[model samples]
Target: MKLATLRRWFSPQTTMQGKIFFAFGLITFLSIVSVTGIVYVNMRDTIKHNAVTSVSDSIRQADESLNIMLEEIDRLNTVVVTSKNTVIDTIMSPNEEISYEWFQEQKRITEFLSVLINYKPYISRVAVVGLNGKVFFTGGPWMDRTVLGTPMLNYMLQNGSRHAYFKPEGAADAITVGREIRYNRETVGIVMVDLDYEFIKKTYGVKPTADSLLYVLDEQNGYVYQSESAPSSFAPSLEKVVEIKRKLAGQGDVMEQKINGRSYIVVSRLSEYTGWSTLALIPLDSLLSESTRIRNLMAEVAIIVFIIILIGSHQVSSRTTLNIRRLRSMMMQVKDGNLSFPKTEIKTKDEIGQLYRVFVSMVDELKRLMEGIRNSEKKKREAELTALQAQIRPHFLYNSLNTIKYLAKLNGVPNIEEVSGSLIELMRGLLGNSNEFLTLQEELDYVFSYVSIVKYKYMEPIQVHTQIEDESLLGCKVLKLMLQPLVENAIMHGIGPSENGGQVLIRVYAEDQDVLIEVIDNGKGMEQEQMDALLGSLDREDAASRFSSMGIRNAHERIVRMFGEPYGLSLHSEPGLYTKVEIRFPKIHHAETSAQEVV
Candidate 1:
């Protein structure tokens, strides 16, 4: 049903103006929609990509900066523990005595450790613990022996340098970085640096915005620092945090994750030195805000353009339809037998205007035709009367010929009776039927009648025989008078110069999908050049093969004109031998052939 409606709408039966307007409007609408959709998709992708890139770069920078501060703390702790400065190392070195030199060395190392705190602001506290029960600290004495007891400091003493998140007793959360001390093959002491929130803010310094949040995470523990400005509504759940970490672990730096039921673009960079992750989460809506705005604006612009174009298209179609409608009205009047011609008033050379001019000219021509028809009608009656007077009554002529034949027979004039009978038979064959096709048997009877008339022209009896492969083919339809001319040509041309009459044989049979007829005659044949000239001639047969090929050419062209070029006649002959003309046509039965025959 939809297909029918579509065809009806687009078919030529619809008004031309409506088609033009619909086409223009459809093209404009589709173009606008397609362009708008493409721009929206591309813009969204570009904006999202830029947002991810921006966040990824920011987090990378934050991680690099945090690594720098962590490295500084590491260098400070190493110097305090392993520095070759005799005062600091001697105090940290494992020894067997508490002598006066050791006391001086410890005092110098204490002042040296105190100087480090005043210079490095990113460090909240620094402390060194020795295996010999000697504890040295700066910024506070509370962290002196307690630093080695903490898991971070203990891990450093047992293995190597390590950093861990901690919330000490009566203190805010901080990162404790530690480096183990070793003298000879055995460990002697360790150095620790406590980084507080103020140090974190100064080192990372990545503040969160209303739409974006920043945080530092510890895979082994928990968050080291979370921005104060981070929205509580966008906080991630335990499952989401695991998902985010899992994604990061899979080697991707940026991912989109839903947090608190809102999508967020998360970007993270891990610091290799401190084993901390610097991460940023930006709301998906905020990131795509600019793209959304552009898409909406484009849609609005497209709508405005479409509206303007629609108005213009309507006006153009209206102008185009005006002339066509005028032409239509004139044609309708003509259909109703009104011959009055109107002024077209259309002057432009467009197709519609041309139609108007042609319509007006047609009306003028129609007026001339009406006048001429009236004048021709009177003459037509007069000519009809003249034709009636000149017409010969065919039945009267046939009866008159029969009467002569009977009188000549009664008078014992055999030749005259035979001539009259042949004449009547010829007349009957010519005027008996109006149809172009007849049964093969019927047509052959007419050929026999014609041969009887020509028999008198020869001294010896003319030989005419028919060979039929299938008796059923005798009932097949063949063109009336098709073989008579060929037989006449064969007898007159082939045996006219011979004292003894030659034979003319007709053969009919079916081969594959076609029926073939051959008229074979023992006659004087033409040369190769004559045959070539006769067959190759398009409009006329050559004078060389004139009498020989005329009847054959007529039959060939008739078969072609009736059944098409492929079903035509082919001729073969040899001088003083036999000349054969073959006729080929589609094998059709009598009833089928009679259904649509030429008259």
Candidate 2:
């Protein structure tokens, strides 16, 4: 007897406190884990967000700098284009008697070039290509020799109507700005402004860090014009040039991408009048270095918080276990098959103390109920046995009939064969014992079978139809027999007594992350009084009354038990028109085999 008691005590149901502690520890650990994960994720995202913002700011600053430089270049171009016209008009005028001073005029042009060169130190040399293809007012004699046979001078003579042209000075080299000289719409000569390559290189400024770099490209012609004082090969590649052109074609102003292990924010803006684009490249890591340091500090703070929670949880659990031990000793005295509880004196009003009070109340009520049941035990036992027998009878009968049907099919009894075959399938479904939850496919199949039976039974009075949106949802699990009860309710309560034949429509579909099942019936719907009684019975605290309102109430209970209260059934009816029963639950995919289990 002692061994048996020990066996029972040590069974899977034993160590309730230990299991509780394990669960509490697990819950606390998971809480910490979840909070830590959230903190880490939020910190990482914040760092990335700050990084992106920093990159954007850097790009903006670089763009502004580029814009200022381009504006200066445009101002110089305007002066050259307009001043060339003034010089040409002076040379072409028919008023020769008006004191012609060629040396003074030459000095004025030279002085203008000198002043411009001094103001914008970027301009290396300036020259005017005359209408006769002769050069005058050169910045230096070397520039005069170097650009003697350039296409810029030839193109100006050929297409004198073109206003401005910017091209490379030589193969893979500096940029040259050429403006055609015109007076009263007549082409006379061309002014060529040559900017030093070094000036463009210096525009990028100093490298901010080892990871950060800056460069400029000629957008219109798809060529690298300048890069920070790094290797010439570090300049933007041909592919980058193509991308710039494609993006600029659509007026794309900003682009972010990683290249050569470094993240860059590229900003491009077109010159309003000249159509030349100025682009800036800024590295991502350099911008977000400070944010990363702050994130590390936050992580350290989270670690400290976790340690405090751990120590506090252990102390709380130890104190809670001691209190529970005292309560358990009192509970043991009432476990002798007679409900007689000892009065608990727990003063604390926390959940544990409330639980103790509830236990005492339950014991007191059980003793009173047992006294009442003692007098009627024999009669109630007999009735319960009979009911249990009756419940088993249908199952036995169904199985026996299936065996007979199998025998008849083997004997080839043709007329009996078809009837027997259908009967066997129907009986098998009705008598089957399987899992409480099934895949949506299995439930739909069961609904189809039930509908087939109902259609055969009430062919003249009822019509049934089903629609499924996505067949892939067949793998999603749902409560077994969830739909059949609603269909049965619709046929019996909503449609059976109608004068005209009615339709029952079942629709299943997925919306967002939820699986929605709706059973709609157009029939003689229930009056408000009947609906109130049904709904009231469903809402009752008594389990027996709730069970009696099985179809809707049981489904509602099971859905809440499995998924949660938020996902369950909702009933709507328009008396004399229609009734709709809708069920919504989280779409859970069940494993085909135990090895494929998700949780």
What stretches of model 2 exceed 4 Å from their correct place?
A: 1-39, 42-52, 76-86, 89-105, 138-141, 145-149, 154-174, 206-209, 212-215, 224-236, 244-274, 277-295, 301-599
TM-scores, all candidates, are 0.40, 0.36
lDDT of each: 0.74, 0.65
TM-score of 2: 0.36
TM-score of 1: 0.40
lDDT by residue (24-77, candidate 2, tens digit) is: 556766776687677666864565555445545654555566456556755675
Q: Best candidate, lDDT-wise?
A: 1
RMSD of each: 22.0, 23.7
Q: Which whole-number lDDT from 0 to 100 does residue 436 have in model 1?
A: 83
Error of 1 at 330 (Å): 57
